[model samples]
Target: MALLARRAARRSAASTKAAAPPAAVAVELSIPAHFRCPISLDLMRDPVTAPTGITYDRESIEAWLDTGRAAVCPVTHAPLRHEDLVPNHAIRRVIQDWCVANRSRGVERIPTPKIPLTPVQASELLFDLAESRDTAAAIARVRALARDSERNRRCLVSVGAGRVLASALASLAADGETPAAALEDVLAALVCMTPLDDEAARILATPTSLGSLVAIAENGSLAGRLNAVLVIKEIVSCIQLTGNVVEELVDALAKVIKAPICPQATKAAMVATYHLASSSERAAAHAAGAGLVPVLVESLVGADKSAAEKALAVLDAVLASEEGRTSARAHALTVPVLVKKMFRVSDLATELAVSAMWRLGRGAKESEEGEATKCLVEALRVGAFQKLLLLLQVGCRDATKEKTTELLKMLNKHKGVGECVDAMDFRGINRLS
Candidate 1:
């Protein structure tokens, strides 16, 4: 009876006591009213000077001034003095706790996802852009891509994404943007590329296949059009990418080299062809087919020294090739142009001309040799020897000096050594050295 009575009393006590109020959940506020109170808005009282020699409000002065320049000091209306101010370190700690508590409400600044494009979609866009028929739409799309900051930002995040790169390259090609503008972007994407995507190859090949890049180099009026140097460099890279696009490159270069239209463009084209000649055999064949030798020979007499110099360089490069030998013979060229160019001596023109002449003179038939040799001797006899000897004296280390030596030796062997020697005396060649 005593145990049951005790159990009942315990049950009554548990039921009679109301459940204690649920434990209060603590809520923190970040900016307290005191800290946030602007000194400019509050009245200053009992101002005391700190080490900075400025008086401020005593009670809330230091607290309000804690955030440097966030509020004016209590006494001064100017911006709160930064040096005299100190941060409320405890506020940051409280903020950390508050952030931890409200993590679900925190805004995460995550990067936006890019509009994912596929290889097929990228290729289709490129195909449309590359078509000559849709040049306007293609250009508009490219301009839009350039202006679309959001899309570009997302693209930057997905730099190595093959589809994005293909689309970007296609856009650049379609717009015909200047090389300087497009080159850096393309190179950046290319460095990150994992494998050359099929879309990338197709888009890249589009321009090379079109053949107008060379034409533009040949005669583009656009302000920053791709020049000959850049064109050849790109074609070389394209050759590496496309494998045996040399034929296409050759045809384009030939077209530019042979285009008789714009002299500057022609000069630029020849310069490009000279660089290309440094690499491929097809350049030699195509240059010969396009009648490059005769054209350059004509440019020698042109008024523009720049064009003439470029022409001479190409001629020199051309004569070094086996096809050049055939071209030289088939044309039955003369040495008068060579003689005139040798006297140029402006830059490398004289040296190139002399070298080209030597190469062309290689293993000439007896009759051809007689004709050239006779003309060369006549030039010497007519007081050309003095200038040749003077050229030898003035640090002529290239083909000019060597050719002079050969010509002097040849004159000696023409059984007219003594007569030529006497003529040299009259022309002051004997006194030059």
Candidate 2:
């Protein structure tokens, strides 16, 4: 009887014992497991659910879809399409609220993600642009969507919006001049939707393409001209423009450099010029004839570093041929300009500048007359000799060093050997000492 009474008393004492303090019991709250992306394993900012019931940050999933894997969900390997990745706004809201609640823990609130333009919507927009029924609204919508996100751009490109936009740019021929505002809108969207597909490249290769782009580059608004030049750079990269078309393209690019709307415009113009001149000697000749050299030289006066480099690159390509060299030699600023570009700009600028000068030397050397000696004297007169020596002093790549040495010897030959060497002040120049 005594043991049974003690056992009952112990059971009641254990049941009446106080629980742990709530202050100490409650620790930090963990984020919900479903709030994280499967691919990134991080909290989802823009949670989007795939067709297979897996959620990911929109950027992560879009990348998975774009890299030739659009047919399957990354997590489940189920069939999917680019059009079916639905945004989980409810989950996004929850994730954001969680972030807000944990503000003291360095957790930042995720921004509301942009709604991506679906491929279906992009297709409809393309149709609207093509039919010219809701042209203005369609153009504005396309521009907005293209500027929104890379995924939207991919969607636009997939539905052939790039080609249609290029067509809109060239439509001045068939439908008369479209409104300038409308054209500029189309240009902005086209600029955003780049790396045009093979079909778009073929469309840009047509004769009308060059004409339309040139008109815009020469006569459009500053923004329009900038966009036009950017598109021209892309278009010229793929197509083989020639004959009168090359001349026209050169003229437009030269005009841009001569009176640039912006540095971007000038640089893009230089890139387009390099593309045309670098491949074909005929194109180089055409560029020279269209008066591009002087324009590039003049643009270099107060230009920034990158612009200077591009200008020199264009000059190097243009001066590769005999006709281009002839035009440059006639220009008063050619040698002085080349000399000034040496060592003051980037290594690429120096290399391009030296290459152009060497081309002039070679061209002058191969002539029937004694122009090589005249060229050497003229280069010396422009102070190119010491720059070449300074080139050697600073140490250069093997090729540039070899050319500089040859040019030095040529200067020695023409200026009476001792006279050329006597001009050197070897204070800082150690390599030639």
Candidate 3:
């Protein structure tokens, strides 16, 4: 009832101001000096009281600390640990009230900010999740808090929510009878707490946790599968993955691609696959053996520019291994797909596709001379030779330009017996680089 009365009074005040006398409206109103953050010189929405006894907008101060140049107070230059910054509720209310009073002057109301989660609150929420008590509500509450503000996310992370969630998932992996829907909810909340600390990464890197995530990536709902792939990507980035773990990651990615979820999931899997293949030769060979090259080859045919670029980059890295080359060489679509992707998607994609074609054209084994002849013949059949010449006639990156020239030379050297190295169609051409 008191809250209702306060809102009614706020409305009355605004109506009064909106109907004020002309002279009263003529007087220019200004924000109080104290209401402006010293760092931003702007009205403070989320005013936090720093240890220096000065208040600044939350985002401004957080940005100051993220610079990592110094941890000292931005105002006082005194040593400051940001964890002590408290929400200045009193100031926030005043600022909001003032905005309401001046609404006729185009003042916009700042909705009340959500109360940040105290460490105790965060711990209790994690406890509920960990203890399996009303688990869905707990996951929803945790996710709601995380989505509330950067401050809430920081508080959750500070209290070790990452490790707790990872441990919970690890337990799910160990105990098989649990419904996978719970895993989905827990993972849904867990995905937002990214850049997980070393301990959390280590925990999720365990075999059981990875196995559960792989299972989700392969068979869970699209949202759950995307979150799983994302978590797997983060874990791979954070820790030193073993051969078996790398293989598992590759297999998950391959499965996701084969199933064809949303673009986000495919891109995540591609990024992870690229990282795994580039990490080591053995991993690259494993990726090829898992049929990544053929899958990428098929996917690249009509892919959008970004996906094509990423797929080509992964294909390039995978082709560095003999296994990748052999696998791609064995594919009927490899040469044609490489040719189709050339000079079309992006500079990077064009460069990678050209490199992949060269690798396939010059197979590692002398006994594969027939493969090389077929590769060149297929390139001619698909007009790859013409595309290479045009790539030079137009412009490209310096390194890509070099690769294009090398490919042109190879084509020239292996031309049909009578074809005098066909001069580039430089009709309106200026000096070539």
lDDT of each: 0.50, 0.77, 0.81
lDDT of 3 by residue, 284-315 (tens): 89889888888898788668888998888889
TM-score, candidate 3, is 0.71
TM-score for each predicted model, relative to the true structure = 0.44, 0.71, 0.71
Report the C-alpha lDDT of model 1 over 1-433, residue by residue, as the tens digit: 9999999999887765433221111122243343232443332222334444454433356456544546564545556542444333344344345445555544122222233333344456446544544544544443344344333322322333444444555565566654633433443333234244455445545553234444444455442233432434443543443334445555566666556545544655676577656455556655676677776665565435677678777777776666664565454233455556666636477777667656554434554664446555554554445555666777677556787667655545553643544533333222211
Q: Rank the candidates by TM-score, best first.
A: 3, 2, 1
Per-residue alpha-carbon lDDT of candidate 2 for residues 1-433, written as tens digits (9 for 90 to 100) = 9999999999887665434332222223456788877887667778888777888888887777777855788767888876677889999998888878877655667889877777788898899889876777887888888878888887788888989987776674345566666667777888888877666767766676667777888888889889888988887888767678877888888888877687788888999899989879888887787787887776666657898889889988988767788777777667767777786778988988888888777664357135545556677766788889888988999988888888887777666533554454423222210
Model 1: clashing residue pairs? none
Worst 10 residues of 2 by lDDT: 19-28
Which residue window of length 10 is worst by lDDT in model 3?
Answer: 424-433
Taking the candidates one at a time, how many backbone clashes does each contain?
0, 0, 0
Question: For model 3, what is the error of residue 386's alpha carbon versus the real structure, in angstroms, after optimal superposition?
Answer: 10
Which of 2 and 3 is ahead in TM-score? 3
Q: List the residue pairs that clash in candidate 2.
A: none
